[model samples]
Target: MTVAANGVLPRPSRRRPPVTWGNPLTYGLALAVAAVSIAPVVYVIVGGFRTTPQIVADPAGLPDPWVFDNYARVLTQSDFWGQAFNSAVIALGTTLGVVVLGVCAAFVLARYTFRGREALYTFFTLGLLFPAGAAILPLYLMLRDLNLINSYYAVMLPQIAFALPLTIVILRPFLAAIPRELEDAAAIDGTGRLGFLWLIVLPLSRPALVTVGILAFVASWNAFLLPLLVLGDVSLHTLPLGVQNFSSQYTSDTAGILAFTSLAMLPALLFFTFAEKQIVGGLQGAVKG
Candidate 1:
């Protein structure tokens, strides 16, 4: 055994780059982005605490003598609550309508390969491209014809219609991810199409549904132009319209406006806080599927 002289193979050494704080570029960039994003929220919150005079005197300074009266006023105002209620109703109604219709449409498009399927999908998607502004005049006329102007339905219906396309788009991919074998098995068991969809598809689609619901809620909540044109009645005004009214009524009352702004934003904030994870997960699932 003429073995070679005992020679050991050299092991490759692993090295990691050392971290250093002296390279503050990344930290500085992150700080800049954070400040840019958070500044408006801080301003609005601070403005809510200060009186109009204080805000005007020092636009960026902290409130010297904090006042809770603005919040109190917003809470106590009858219009505030009434408008908030109207907004809630409209947003909830729109979300429900869009999700129901969108899911049904998505199921059809995803599961059934029928004639004109692509055309139907395209037709529904076309709504997404249609600007709310473009349809305002026609919507106004239609609402007038139906005598729904200034009613919650005027705002609610259009919001549902406007949101439906995006909802369908979001849900179609999720629905497509579901195994066809499941539906076939249900069919073999004599389950009707609607039964399978209602029982199996809907349950499996909770994440996507929640994601769409949140999106619809946000869209309906933040809507301005549609409600502005349709909801002429101050009593029926949604939050966006209500905020506009608040601003107009109290243009000089900076604190009051900020208070109302903060209040108006609470629902959206709470909604995102609760459903944000679901929304992200659902989106990821849809993409992966």
Candidate 2:
């Protein structure tokens, strides 16, 4: 047997594992799901250029006589620009507020446990149970009492408050995972709490920050009810409110509605397109933390 083994090649030692996509059915199903999800977005963008009649006749097909007038008209509208600017302001302000307050609060709660810490955190976490729409009545009353109606603060303040709970939830786990030894070393080397936060904790927390910041920005940009309730001035309308108003103003114009909606959604789409990888990558790192 030993001599025979030497004379002939040995039998194969092992078999390779099957390739992941070797199953046609599995890949086919994945492609179907992707197509289903992407179809509506594609239709919206394409349908924006179609006339009302064309859209009605062939809702899923390309425009025969493509109309650029609808988008061009919207582009020239001052109200569109005003609302878009308002949306940018609200998104930026709310994200900044949530980041600064959430980071500082999450750092303290995660690093140094004190009396009522659990209670406070639980209280904030409870905010997640109820959405902004659920608390509309009281929110309106509080804002009215503060004379903040029809103001940017009316929108931004509530958004900041509502965003905090989620920000804390995202940030606390990551911050708590930070090594205490590094903070202690910083303290020995003349770093105060603020200094340790700025020089150490914040730098290490880029992933969590990016994740929460994007979330807050997106949520604020897409907010509807709060802005609708608080903002009576047409000039102060955000993008969502603008879309609603635009649709109402052009009630008979389906093409205009589709075009406005497509335009309104473009900022969010472009932002996600670029930052999709960042959000995914950061989330992977943050989950480990």
Candidate 3:
């Protein structure tokens, strides 16, 4: 070590790990998996642009003469817009309910020391194993008795309930990881539990919240059987149901059916695509916590 004029030795420089381009084999496998997953979606979307005759002639060929009439027709339909509105309402409603309730419950479990708190958290965790399909019969009966059939609440409430388990699981770690010193500081400043949560915790947990919100929105948007069983009226049907109805009504119009299917799935795909980073970040934080 070299000494300075005042007899102080200089500190050694720290070395960082080398950057990696990763394994070519791993990248090749990822590309293969991605192509397998994406091929069908690409086919459906591109198929919408070809005539039924063209599709029949070459199932895997590109559209020689691209067509927009199918998409235009679906867009012009009043029922298409109606179904989109229904989907938006249900998705947004489910997201709101899940976020608000999940955060409050997670906060209590994370911060408060109460009897059976671990048990309670365990119970919610068990909810992850409870598939909606298993509860469909009893759920339908209960909703029918409540006279909630054919309404948005019938769809929204169940989606929120099913989504809550994962939401709380994702968020509790985030909330619990909040430095206890911060809470003490807030208390010294006269901030109560509610104020602390509203003023500090919520802001810190925004990533997890956004992650859960996007998940709920996408799940609600794609749900089909629940809406089918609860909403018998065509007017109340969401986009998934609308796709079913459209396909049935135009069984012979292959291109039209493809167009309608593409449109039906577009919203969820777009939502998920835009929020992909938020989801990855939230889960990483949860795991680290």
Candidate 4:
């Protein structure tokens, strides 16, 4: 330790090291994987600007003279907008349901002490292993019997249920990390349990909630099989179902199909992109806790 003229030792520096990209091979592999995942999406968006002849001549070539006709036509279609609205409704509904239910359940599991609490949490953890595909048959039958087969609830309800486990899993740790002193302080300040949760817990857990909400929204937006099984009506179709129907209807119109697909997926991609940081922060907090 260095001593100053006054004979006091200097304070140690706490600055972090300068960051650098480590492991060239790892970065190369990551870039390769990202390229592979992104190539098809890029192709679809770029293909929307090319004519059918250009695509047929050079399957992987860029647009020579970019044209906006494909996208323009898609925008002009009433079906596209209608399907988009349906998708927005379902995604938003699913996000709201998942966040509300997941938060309530996670708060209970994290804060309360009771018999079978761990068991209940474990039961929810087990739900993670159950995929929607396995239960689609019975789900469809149940929805059908309930006369909800053609309704938005048919998709939103099951999606919320399937999303609950992960949502709670991510949120429980975040909520539990709230120091007990804060709860006591809130109690002394005339805050009840629900009021504490509302006034303090929710604000503190915003990142985790946003993470789960975006996940649920994106999942619901991209869902196909459930909507396909339940939403047979053309008027009720979500974007995925709309994409399939559009592709089928325009089998030979490759450019138009590509445009339609690009448009359909753009919203979810944009939404996720914008909220990427919250997702990472929430997951990091969960891991830290």
Candidate 5:
């Protein structure tokens, strides 16, 4: 028996609760997981500042003198900026296309119950399973036939097509989560189908839309194979292709390659950082719904 604060004997000190081994083990495992996940990013950041010789010599240590010229070279280089612009345009265009088409498709899929609906979804989703590389020849021929090869539109169109299925997959559930009463209420208030979508669905889907937008941006921005095959002009090359050029031009300059790689990754990094909260919130909403 335990004594009470007052002088009476209390219940055996309530036995304090037994500390299990699981708690400490779980904390240790979580810390280990976090460290593993962070190690590569740390390595990349450190390696970006080191010279080729330093990286070849150490491969793992912090840069001794911490040279910043890598960043300076990347920023000052004219090719880098132009390629970055190409990436930006493609990413923006793809995001817009995916959003417009995905939202429309998702609205139909979620709100309607027509025949062959599942088959239609399956057809759209088939694109996701088909590797973009597998479609290269077909895409090239089609774009060439349309006289769009070597043009930004060629890359932009394929990127949008490839990204649409995933965007639709993301948006469908989010659209479904919205209560039907909202749309019915809007309809009762004289809102037409387009008006209902424009005012009701679009506004409520900001988070999901932002999430898909970020995904589309990143995918299109980093697209290598499609653009590489289609875009032949140096002026039209995206960041990934530009980095490949940097590698070819500076084959002996490993430091320069690392620098270019680091520079190429910057836009994606900044975009994810800025949109991380919205992405997380959107995913959580989708999961909870």
Candidate 6:
């Protein structure tokens, strides 16, 4: 400790915590993990701009002669946008449904005491333990019986249901953490429960909502089995389904396949990248609660 000019002892400075680079092992491990995770994505996206032979010859390298026409070709294909639209519709629909319903249900579960509430919440959480694979056959049969086999609703509804479990689980903690005094204060301001939800709760809960929405959107966008089992019409296929079909439709055009994959993957990557803070904050808040 250093003495001040006035003879008062100065406070010792705190040391900075070690960063990944501060420890060689930590830095090396992170680098290795990053390379492992990122290499495949880079190759696929970059490979989209290379000829099949170029990729086959040097799969690890950049395009020998970069090709933009592969993307242009995919863009020109009408089915590309159609599949994208279908994916968008399903993802957006699922996200909206999950967020709205999750918020409401989670609010009720967290704030209100009711009969069978614990039972209902437990049942919902149980859904997380059961994989989608377990319910696919029955889910398929139910949708088939409803004559929804060829419709987007068939895919969207199941996703919304499956998403609700995690959505409710994540949202409950956030909702519970909202000080009851805030609700009381809002009530004195003549806000009804619904108004409180919209004006106070919703705004305050934006982080959790955004996190839930992003998760739901990504899950729905990448969903394969539900769409595959429910949607029989080729035109209604989502991107993942479309990507599977593209393999057969353009087996000879590896560039097109890679380009299609990159395009399909781009949206979720962009979404997560842009809203990373909200997701991280939301998760931390949920965990803390």
Predicted structure with the largest lDDT when compared to the true one = 4
Q: Each model's RMSD to truth, in Å?
A: 8.8, 7.6, 8.1, 7.2, 7.4, 6.2
- Model 2 clash count equals 0
In what order do the candidates fall by lDDT, top score first?
4, 3, 2, 6, 1, 5
Total clashes in model 6, counting residue pairs 3 or more apart in sequence or in different chains: 0
Question: Which pairs of residues collide in candidate 4?
Answer: none
lDDT of 5 by residue, 1-289 (tens): 2223442233466766455344454567677889999787767766779888998898778899899988788789648999988888888888899899899998998888899998998898888798888889998999999999888899988888888887888888888889989989988999987788899899999889998888788778888899988899888999999988889988878777887887788778887888889778766754664
Candidate 1 global lDDT: 0.84
Predicted structure 5: lDDT = 0.83
- Residue 199 of model 4 has an lDDT of 95
Candidate 6 local Cα displacement, residue 78, angstroms:
5.1
Candidate 5, position 40, lDDT: 76
Give Cα-based local distance difference scores for all models: 0.84, 0.86, 0.89, 0.89, 0.83, 0.85
Name every residue pair that clashes in candidate 1.
none
Residue 52 accuracy (lDDT) in model 5: 82
Which of the two, 2 or 4, has more TM-score? 4
Stretch of 10 with least lDDT, candidate 4: 1-10
After aligning candidate 2 to the native by TM-score, how far in Å is the CA of 58 from where it should be? 4.5
TM-score of each: 0.86, 0.87, 0.88, 0.87, 0.81, 0.86
| Predicted candidate 3 versus true structure: per-residue lDDT over 1-289, tens digit per residue | 2212432223346365355554556567678889999999999999999988888889889988999988998899638899999999999999999999999999999998899999999999999999999899899999999999999999999999999998889899889989999899999999999999999999998878998888788889889889999999889999999999889988888999999999888886887789889877866865764
Tens digits of lDDT, candidate 6, 1-289: 2222432223346465333223455456678889999999998899999988887677677897898988888889638899999999989998999998899999989888889999999998999898888999999999999998999889888888988988899999888889999899989999888788888899998878898898788888889998988888888988888888997888988888999889888988998899888778767765764
Query: What lDDT is reached at residue 119 by model 4?
Result: 99
- Report the lDDT tens digits of candidate 4 across residue range 146-251: 9998899999999999999989999998899899999999999999999999999999988788988987887888899999999999999998999999999888
Clashing pairs in 2: none
Model 6: how far residue 107 lies from native, Å: 1.1
Show where candidate 2 strays beyond 4 Å. Answer: 1-22, 56-61, 278-289
